[model samples]
Target: VNEILDLLYTNLETYPSVRTWVFQKVETVYTLDVRQISGPQFGLCFNASHLHSEKIHEFLYTKLSSKLERDTLALWNLLISLLAPDPSTVTGVRLTKYRKGKRKDNTGTDAVVDYEMDNENLEDGGKILDHEAEIDEMAVHDLGLITVVCQYLCHIASIMAHSTNMRCNALQTAIGFFLEASNAPKTVCELLAHSGMSVSAATTSRMLGPLRSQCEMKLKGLG
Candidate 1:
């Protein structure tokens, strides 16, 4: 899986046309920028955009209709369609105004008090009338399909990028640390490591040692 994903990412980067298409697509929703890195695989980084996910996905489908493998394209299309946001649903946070309903019980000043005599009972109904509705901030939009796709792709990319390099695999390294904290047995640790779910137990222990030293130093400093 790691090798497959890594190959896919490398292919994505190597193809100038694909890179340009991706850049154009993402630029619709997020501000795009390219950054150079010294990494062996990745050379440039770009930002996401502000364009609507629906349009972006549509454009993607149109462009890759004949290019991607039928199964892959079908899966992509299915995922996009399934995750697409409903037009009726709200998309983001916005301030909205609403009125509080009036209550029905209190008497007005003109109503007859026990000490005063009045012909008719004037009702106030405990109504507090305000001309303006209360304003509230709330989320109006559902999560964008494109946003989810981009984030999912990014995480997958991160995992694949570090798959072979456990020393720099932050996600797996964190998982390894969690396993260590739980005192998982060597067999279990090795199983997960071999499965590419985390760094090896040895690497976890090596990392923990430095972290432990730093923690001890901090504690001594307080003393």
Candidate 2:
């Protein structure tokens, strides 16, 4: 475990500056049984981050007890980085040629949805204006990526569900997405599928029993 941590720690000595943002989601319209009409869209982003290695001993000043938290945060960091733009590889508007600020800021884990890669090694010519048309045609299908994003949503939801904030940010975010112009039910499936997690809505409903009830109680308190 120590050896593994040593290696991983060596890789992230410098907090990554790359940004991964989903520029668009590919929408697919189809019909299920009973002539059910549905329109599903996917969330896609262009990443611009890479990995490197260096010394570790200069960083880990604490003992091994912090190993678990360190590893978990490390994994999350790496995972988010993987969603960013890789210069030598990823090209086009996917490289944040015209975006601004970090979408993941107040968005919790939405970094993967709209990360504007830091302009460290790249030149910012007038190309920013040319990106509109290229990025306007955005939409991707990667359920695995969506799954990770959903977890962030769930985490935020769970937090807001219990927090004293009468206005639930997490709940609001979820509701905004689910209640927006998109197909709510199918979007859930799209996100979960991308993450390779399949827990039926029935199962989810059941799991939400306690949370849902608690939320209702809170809502009532606001009155």
Candidate 3:
């Protein structure tokens, strides 16, 4: 199971297009399972002995949460989709005032609906109004929004550049074979696999020196 999971995480970048679909399908499976187990009519038979078992619920939740965290690229894609301006909303004419409900002519309605739907789906969407200026003002007020957006974009760039050198085979082999291995050996092998390199331990150590130094410098700057 760990090997399978490590493999999935390693090749996640290769399936970028299908990542969203995969996430949705996984969510759907969980939802269906939850519904079947907890539904009123089926609750008794499934209770404790079957789907509603405490152990199973805990395991499922743990797996889902871990997957959500590990699948950073998928989360980044979701964030981009959320932040992107809807095509339907970009109109030549800016209405001086906004009103709710369907427009008599459906020409501009699609854009409005799309924008609203996206906003509504967001975690804090309810707090945000449909006003363009209001949304911009909120974004400006929240420095965290800027920080999060920057971090997400940086992650996307790292994935695109394949900078992390975190790969499936190396991860799986490390987890599967080196459960008892020393940290130094595991780290060295994983790095080699991820980077597709054949460097000696001394060379790998030398390469990390500058990277660590840069990180410390940035930390000091932030401080």
Candidate 4:
């Protein structure tokens, strides 16, 4: 995992494009069911739906250690590009510092206009724009990204608390899909198929008891 993360960071320049593809794939899968045309099909559709989901989880976990880190890094890079500072000016500042007795803003009774022309040239070029626009743009982007990541994380937590609470209601959806798939030995087979478990009616009934109790307890606590 460390090696994989290192490799990803080493090639982090490709992250934007990779993130775009991953986001699109995740959205498509979450919105549409891969089980629609089921007959043990295994191809791009399967890989795109399942394998891509796994990859997305891995990438998100690896890239975003905490909410702060993810939001900060993305915003920082966007802001940096938007600001677009002049390299020459930065280099000139460093060079000036390196030259001894060339103190910035030097003052004396006998003064000299050593860099007068340089200052005049810049002044004539017009006012240098501050990065207010870049800061605003970054604020908007950061807010949007943070909102998206938080919403998804909350959704996952909700689903984990109660499988039935999945944002897309996957458990209920699976049950409905299975029932619609077949009718023979209807209830038993359908429940077993949907739940991914083989058991008698009594066991099936008991299986949901704990979950139901948990939901009721959570609701009561909220109240």
Candidate that would win on TM-score: 1
Error of 1 at 213 (Å): 0.7
Model 4, span 1-223: residue lDDT tens: 8786556645769767766776897656533332221212211111212222232223332232243134334433333354444756743443333222234335434343344337654543232223465346546755766566554442332233223222223222233333444543757665654453322333334434554576677899999
Record all residue pairs in model 3 with backbone atoms less than 3 Å apart, i.e. clashing: 88-111
lDDT of 1 by residue, 113-189 (tens): 22221222112211211222222122122234344554443334334445534333544565677798899988999
lDDT of each: 0.43, 0.35, 0.41, 0.40
- Candidate with best lDDT: 1
Per-residue CA lDDT of model 2 for 31-131, tens digit only, reads 11101100111001101121011111122212211321243343334335555545444443445533422345556564455444455524552364256
Off by over 4 Å in 4: 1-130, 164-223
In Å, residue 3's CA in model 1 sits off its true spot by 35
Model 1 Cα displacement at 150 (Å)? 7.0
Predicted structure 3: lDDT: 0.41
Which lDDT value does model 1 have at 31?
A: 22
TM-score of each: 0.35, 0.25, 0.21, 0.20
lDDT of 3 by residue, 102-170 (tens): 352446554443234343334343333466775665456455555565544433333332222322111
**What is candidate 3's TM-score against the reference?**
0.21
Looking at model 4, report the run of 10 residues with the lowest lDDT sum. 39-48
